[model samples]
Every structure is written in structure tokens, then in C-alpha cells.
Target: MRNPSRTMLYSAAGIATAFILVVAVNIIAGALYVRGDLTADRVFTLSDSTKKIISEINAPVHIRFYYSKNNPQTPGNIKSFASRVEDLLEEYRMASHGVLKIEKLDPAPYSDAEDSATMEGIESQLLSSGERIYCGMSISCLDKSQNLPFLSPQKENLLEYEITRAIWDVTHDVRKTVGVISALPVLGMNKVQPTAESIASGKFAPPGPWIPFKELEDTYEIRKIPLDAESIGSDINLLLLVQPVGMSAKCMLAVDQYLLRGGRLIVMLDPVSLYSIVKSATDPSYRETVSCNLPAFLNAWGIKFNNNIVVADMTFATRIDMPQTKITYPSILDITSKGINRSNTVTALLEKIGLVFAGFFEFTEGATLKKEVLIHSTADSMPVSSFLANRPEMLVRNFSPSGKVFDMAVILRGDFKTAFPDAGKNLLRKSISSNSAVVLVADTDFLFNDVCVQFSKDQFGRKFYVRKNDNVSFLHNLVGYLSGDNTMINIRGRQTITRPFLRIGALKSKSEQEYKNKILDLEKDLIQTQEKINNLQKENSGRYSKYVFSPEQQTELRKFQEKSVAARKELKNLRKGLYGSIDRIENTLKWLNISLVPAIVIIVGLSWAAAVRRRSSSK
Candidate 1:
């Protein structure tokens, strides 16, 4: 009751002190990084293999970020973006359990460290003349002898992955064994394949996920074999088989036994080939084409290969020429994004990927199957004869009139028991029984080099894009998914669409030279006709030169005019006969580009992204 003013003063001072403490904590929190993963589907989330590498780090890791905070490239406007990048790295550091450290360095006063960033492959563009800007990073593992991939600290979205992968690689030694055997060469030098040299030379080409596995000579031992080779090694963790043509029954059985031993298997078969150089327009090489139908293990797993055909619809087709809307026949088979499953890891985060020249498979209901169509034909698709695989001539409107849809591609799987009655036994050793699951695909042409090369240009006067099919991606995911182990050790990659120019066709020898000679003959005929018309006009130059007239000169002009007109008409007809619509091919491609590719991308991109995200989240 005494001294009320003094009591009030004391309460006010206490309130002020609490407020100051709160403000101080907020500032420190802003400086420090915490995790805020709002993404419903963690596509940007660390892959299982990647996560394993990071969790296994036994020593402390340090990452130094070298970015000029005041540089033109690091404008105040984009500083928020930079801060986000900084925060992401901090999250990795936090995830590392005090084993990760990050140091921010503002390159000061023409430092030599700035030069090192460029040499380490951190790309920077010039914001102004003579003013170059770079954002660089160096990752150090506690171990001195381990190898790590270089990373750009500046990029957004991928910053977390970049930093974490680099840290894991440098900190821990990756030592997992993978085995490969395929019709398409990847584990070997691949010189026997078409783009082998280009792929080998690292010509800025798209990388197949299998390349890293092939390059693991220093860490893990790699074993290779032909499709016909029998008996896979027992110690192999993953086995790959691609486009096995005329493999002996024993070889196929060997693969089956390997899987029976709980070994991972990836089989890439095809219903029909889109790009086959089978000696002619009518080559009978369906040996692999028809034979690749997965006979035993597929049905055992409750999956079905219809051995049918697929055709595209107007809704899903990509146009090669818009004015003419010349679309590529069979070249563009539209798959509904619904074909992708949100529950599967392989395609959960996939987007509108162009599997240029692919086939689909279907599943039966008899077995305990969890069937997911990774890619499917649109409702507008219909079945065509497999006989038409190489018929480029069928790429016209007449071939695909309207209204036809069918299912083409599928990914079928489940806790498959076995195709063989006694499948529990191992491939090389009878003591071990197989518990490994099976994953199979019905397309093989997409894996070949020529099918994947950018063979033509686009309508924008740009080279057409050719992203090598996820042939290798499909294989790597198959093994990783089936194994239930994240240490597969070789699946970090990016692929972009490719564009190629038409200026580099091969020179023809005699037989093909004869075709060009025929074209030359047609050209000569056209020239002669043009010359004759010119000469005829010269004689009557005064009257018919401009050719504006009344009736007065009718008789005199008749004979000359009739001959000139007839010659012109004949030459036009002859040109049409020789070239047919071949000349229109270029124009058609232009039209297709304008009308088809963009529309296809938009429709597919939106639909596909939604489904892809769904799948990614479940994984």
C-alpha cells in the first residue's frame, strides 16, 4: 500500500528488459540456418543413395563459399536469393551433426583465391564490361585421399544437392560393385557403337547414369559380359541386360537364376523399333524385335506383354510443320501423364520427357501385382502393324487419319515369387535362394546411339534437341529400387533436349550415289526446259516480254506463247514427279515445330509434372 509510483517503475523496467532479449534472439536466428522443407514431393530432396553417402560421413566436413557480396552479379535485389542459398548449405551443415562447417568469404581486393574459382569450373558471367562475377565453393572431407565432385555454390534449387553430394563424396569412399551386359555398349569403351567416340571424348553430350558405374575402376570392381554369356558372378550386386538378341537359352536362364538369388535385374525389351537400319525398308530382322518378348520371368511376376502395336492421336501428336502441321507419324506417341504413378520412385519426380521412339507394355490381373504405367499412349492412340517399323513413308496424314487410341508402355511389378518351379536356388551356387524382385521394360531402340542422336534441325533455325532416352536411367533405377539398398553408388546426372543440324550427312558410295545421279538427271532436264522457254521469249521480246496485251497481237504471239507455256507446265510436273513430297520434308518439319512440339510440351509438361511430383513424394 505504500509507495505505489515506485512499484509501477520497477514493473516497466522489467518489461523493457524482456523485450530486448527477444529482439536479440530473433537477430541471431536470422543469421543461423534452419530447415523449412515445404515441398510436398521432395524431388529436390536428397535421393536415398545420396542420403546414405551423407549419413556415413565419420569425419567433419568443411565447405568455404567464395562469393563477392558487393559484386554486380550479387546485386541487392538478388541478395535474398543468395541468402536462401546460404541457408540451404547451413541446413546440410546441421544435418551433418556438427560434422559439417560452412565459411562465407567475400573475395577481397583482387585475391588469388578468385582465380582458383574459375579453374575449379565455377562459371560466372560478366555483369558489366570488364567486370566478371563468380560464385564458388570448395568442399573438404576429413579424409585426404577421397575423391569428390566439384560444385557451383551459386546455383539455386540444386545448391543443397550440390553441397551435400560433394561433402559425402570427399568424406567417404564409395565401394559398391555393379555388373553390366547389354546389346548397347556402356560399360566398355563403346567404340563399337555409333556415337561411342563422341560419348567417350565427353563432347558435352548427355550422360547416361551408367557412365559413373563404368568409371568405378578405382573404387569398386566392374564386370562386363555379352547378352549370350552364361552364368553371372555370385558376388555381383546388380546385373544389367539390354536388348538381348539371340542369347542362348542357358544365358537367359543364367540371368533368371541370378535374380532367384535375390540379385537385381533390369531387362530392356521392345515391341517394335522406331529407328532401325536393317539393310532395307523391308528387312526381316524381327529376330530381336519379336524375340525380345520377356517369355518366362515377366508372366511369373504377373505382368503381360501384349505383343501389339501403338499409334498416336491428334491430341497427343507433335507437329513437325505447323502451316501444314506436318506431324511425325509413329515418331510422336502421346502418353497421358496419368500413365505415371505417384507411388513409384522411378517416375515420381519425372516431367515431360521425350522418349523419342518408344513402345509400351500391358499387365494382367492374375498375380499379386502393383502395376504402374510409367508412360502410356494417349486415348487417341491405335494399334498399327509391327511390319511398319521402318516405313518412314508412312509418316503422312493419310497414314493416321483420325480417332485411334491404345496403351503402349507400362511398368509392372510386385512381390513376384518366381517363374521357375525351383527358383529359390542361386545362379552360380545352389546353396543360396533368390528373393530379388524383377522390373522389366518393353522398349530397347531408345538405348541405341543413332536413335538418340539429334538427327535433324528444328523450325526455329536451331538444332533439334536429343536427350538420350532414360535407357540408362531406367536401368539404374531398376537395380536401385529392387535392391532396397541406397549404396548403388552411380546415379547422379542431368539430361537436356538436343538439337542437330542437317549439314553433316555421310557421303554416299556407288549404290547410293546412283540415287543422287538420278536426281541430277532430273535437274538437267529442268534446266533444258528453262533454257528453251528463255530462247523462245527472246525472239518475240518486244510483244511478249512484259506480256501485257490486247487482241491485236493475238495470232503472232500464239505460237511462241503456246510453246513457252507448255514447256513451263511440263517442267513443273516433272519436278513434282521426281521430288514427290521429299522437298516438302524440310517445310513439313518447320510446320510441325510451330504447331506440334510446343503444344505437346505444354500439355505434357503440366500433366506430367503433377503426376511426377506425386510419385516422387511416395519414394
Candidate 2:
């Protein structure tokens, strides 16, 4: 006989004690800082570059997050992302150890907080009910300020990168100056064909800069240099030389001197440039072959590239629309993750890059400088002559795989000897005493407008250019690497938590290879059968129109028709088998993922129950 009131009192006391313990634990956690990032990719952990930048903060930089909480106008997904953004900011705050202060605000509609947010440049979205929802960030240090107008969920993957870049920009006052000396129309200066009306009006405006060039202008000061400039200005931080054909000896000497003085360089040299063809079709003066090289300068830098050869890879071929036909052009490479340098910070995170008429490079044997290949072709790649690359039809006819990998891009670092050491060049250092850096890309048309950008009209009929690939990102990252800004370069292509299944991928690849062989055999049979039918029909048509076909011709036609049908059936069956194998494997994986944990739990439960029964019997 137990007292129900006493038992109820004990239960109540236990619940109160548990609540107090939880509250105390939470309070202690808030006072102390601890972060455990258990994700495989360390998605929550701040990158080393970000931490380094934060650690060097001398002045106090404050970030204000203006979020609309519990507003019916705000979408649920955005609210979740807002919480993630706050957590990320907390990581930054902890990493900064007090140099970075964060202020989170919930701006109610028409409230003073909302007014403050609007003044700080945070944008607000209006709902159907006339309510405003704010989701953005504003960072300020003393007088200088930087604002992210809106934080869209579409760009959530770039949240950390955007915030870190904003902080770095607000703190840094100087922008790097990049000097360009391009033979092609990189500045897009009056290159379009003259129209009759425009000619009559005498109104010809210079063409706007290409999309990539426009993007660069947003972050860097672009200074275009003349082709025959005698000297490179000392104020330039990085020098970009594209298609440097027919350059004067003095200009080459000037470039040599610039590099010897520790200047960063990005050189785009191509053996065959399709973009040049388009530009030269209208203007003969700009019509130049893709043979441009400063041999004296390149040899001294421990780089050797044949300006007469172009690399063509079947594994990475990009399709081109030609006259009356579409074909995959091996010279225009569509480089994917497999071809990029995953270990190098400059190219590690890039997905796909498009390059036209690319060439390959190799270092001279016994070279003094250290070289690292940044982009490479597949094993089924070979170097083709520029003659084949110029003619689209001939390129396909003469294509063959060399079964070797070629280097499409590389970084050369260390001391470089001047090629004209004894040529009485004034003030020439003859060699770089300390290590210097230069990036050599074997393609020139990668940044061209026709290849890198696509134009589209919005619903309002306004036109805009969109990047077709990561060429713009690659160029920006290269310049950032040259300017010694590691924060933007390191976080541009990072994938925090997307892990792929390598084993399943390998199986799929194996199946594809088998299927490819089967398809090839079927195509051969179909081609042969069609040829026989064509000959029979040609002989019959060439004779009198009223003449009937011979018995042998009739038999041959029927046989060929039956052969075509059988080939089609076999091809269909091959595809079915290939898909079936892949589907079965996928289903097995799904079942394992759904049941493995529960199966283990049941096994453990049964073992415990049996042990308890045995112990009772023994007692």
C-alpha cells in the first residue's frame, strides 16, 4: 500500500530538477566557446585562409544581420537559411576572438529597426499584404561600409565566401591594377560590321568590353597597353599578354625585365585561335595566325611550347555547329573535374572549363625553374598540326589519339635567366635572383566573347550576358593568385559537404565501356548493309525506268532490309541490359541504406532478451 500523493510529489520533484540542470548546462555553454564540426567536409569549420584574415584584423569590424523573424511574408526555406547564416557568423565571431562583433536584429515592419536596415542599404521584399521582409547583411568599420543588398537562398552555397570577401574588402583600401596587352579585340573596340544607317549618321561607338573583362573591371583596374609599347609601367601589379604576335624586340625585352623584377605574369599563347578567325574575317590587319611566342623569353623561363601544334582530346571534346553538320571538335576542350589540378589552390575547386584551339606545353629538360602542371588532357589525347585545327572538316578526318597525357597549363616558379643576357640590353638583371611566378595557359580564345559568354533576353526584352562556363572564374582566380589574395582564391570552388560514391561511379563507367563496344559493332553492320542496298538501287535506277529488278537484286535488297531490323533489335537489347544492371545495383544500395540500422538494433535486442531469460532461470 503506497501513498499516491507522495509518489506524485517525487515525480514532480524529479521533473523540476531535470529542468534546472538543463538550464544550468545551457548557461555554461553560452559562457564558454566550443565548436565541434562533425561533417566530413568540415562545412562549419572556418577555412585556414579565413581564419588567417580574421586574425590579422587590427580594427574592430562589426557585422549586422537584419532578419525578419516569424513574418508570414517570409518563406520557410529562407528562414532556415537565415539560421544557417547566423551559425556561420557565430563561427566567424569565435574565430576572431573579439575582433569581429556580430549584431543580430529582427526588423518588424515599419519599426525603427526596419528603418535602420533600410538606411544601411539592406533591401526589403514586399509581400501581397504590403508587409516588408528583410534579409541581408551590412558590415562597417568606422566610416567605411560594405553591404550585401540581399541574401538569396539561391546563393547559400557562397554564403561564407561572400561574407569573408565583404569583410576583407571593407578592411583593404587598395585594388590591384592589371595591365593587358592583347592583339585580339579584348576591349571590344569598334569591331562589329558597319551598318548603312550608322555609316550615314557617322555614329560608330566602341564595342563594350567582353563579359569576362567587364567582371574583372568590377574588382580590378584594367589598363590596356599598346602592342609595341617599349616599357611596362612599374605601377602595374600583374601583366596579361594575350596573342602577343609580331611584338618588337624592345617590347619582348621590356617583358623580360618586368619578370626579372618580380612582376607576376599571365600569358595566353595559342597555336590556333578560332576567335581570331571570326575577328579577322572582317579586318585583314587583325587576321593573324596563332603563331606567337617570345622564344628568347620563354626558353629562359624554362618553358617550351610548339606554336605549330594544337592538342585535341576526344575525352574532352566540345561540340561545334558547322555548315550543314554538327561535330565534336577535339581542339575545343571541355575540361571537367578529372582534368583539373585538385591539389593546387588556383584550380582545385573548378567544375568545368571551356577552351578553344588549346596547345600543350612541356618543360625543357634540365631546366632550372620548378614547374607544376595546372590543367592536363586525358590519356587519349594527341597534338595535331595547326593546319588541321584551322579546317573543321579536316580536323575530324585526320584525328587520332596518341595515348598520352599533355599539359595544357602550368605554373613556373623560381629563378629565370634572361635569353638576351649578352645583347647589351641596358639595366637588364640577366636573371631573377629570387623565386618569381608566371602562369602559362595554352589557349587564347578561352576569354573571348563568342566562346565564353552567351547572350539572352529577359522577360522584359532586356538583354544580358551569362557566363557559359568557368572561364571567367578561372581568370579571376588566376589574377587573385597573382595579386597574393588567398581568401577569394581558396573559397571560390569549395564543396563543403557533397561526397560522391566512387565505387558506384566506377561500375557505371565499366558498363558504359561494354555498351560502347556493342554499339560500335552494330553501327558497323548497319553501315555495310546500307552500302549494299545503295549499290543495288543505284544500278536499278540507272537502267530503264520500266525495267524490273533482277532476282539476285531482289534477294539482296530483302536480305539487307532484314539485316537492318536485326541490328536495330540487338542495339535495343544492349541498352536494356545495360540499364537493368545499373538499376539493380542502385536498388540494392537503397535497401541497405533503409534497413541496415534497424536490423542491427533488432539483433541486439534479441540477444539482450535471451541473456535476461537465462539469468532468471539460473536464479
TM-scores of the candidates in the order shown:
0.56, 0.75
Find the candidate with the highest lDDT and give its number. Answer: 2
Q: Candidates' lDDT values, in order?
A: 0.52, 0.79
lDDT of 1 by residue, 126-236 (tens): 454456554567777654422222222222434454454466557656545667675443454433333777867777344343343433343444677766776878778
lDDT per residue, candidate 2, 121-178, as tens digits?
A: 9988766667778889999877778898778765576678778878887787788899
Score candidate 2 by TM-score against the native: 0.75
Model 1 misplaced stretches (Cα beyond 4 Å): 1-57, 67-84, 105-134, 144-159, 171-174, 188-222, 274-291, 294-316, 319-331, 334-336, 362-374, 387-434, 445-476, 486-619
Model 2, residue 261: C-alpha shift (Å): 2.7
User: How many angstroms is residue 24 displaced in model 2 relative to the true structure, after the best TM-score fit?
Assistant: 8.8
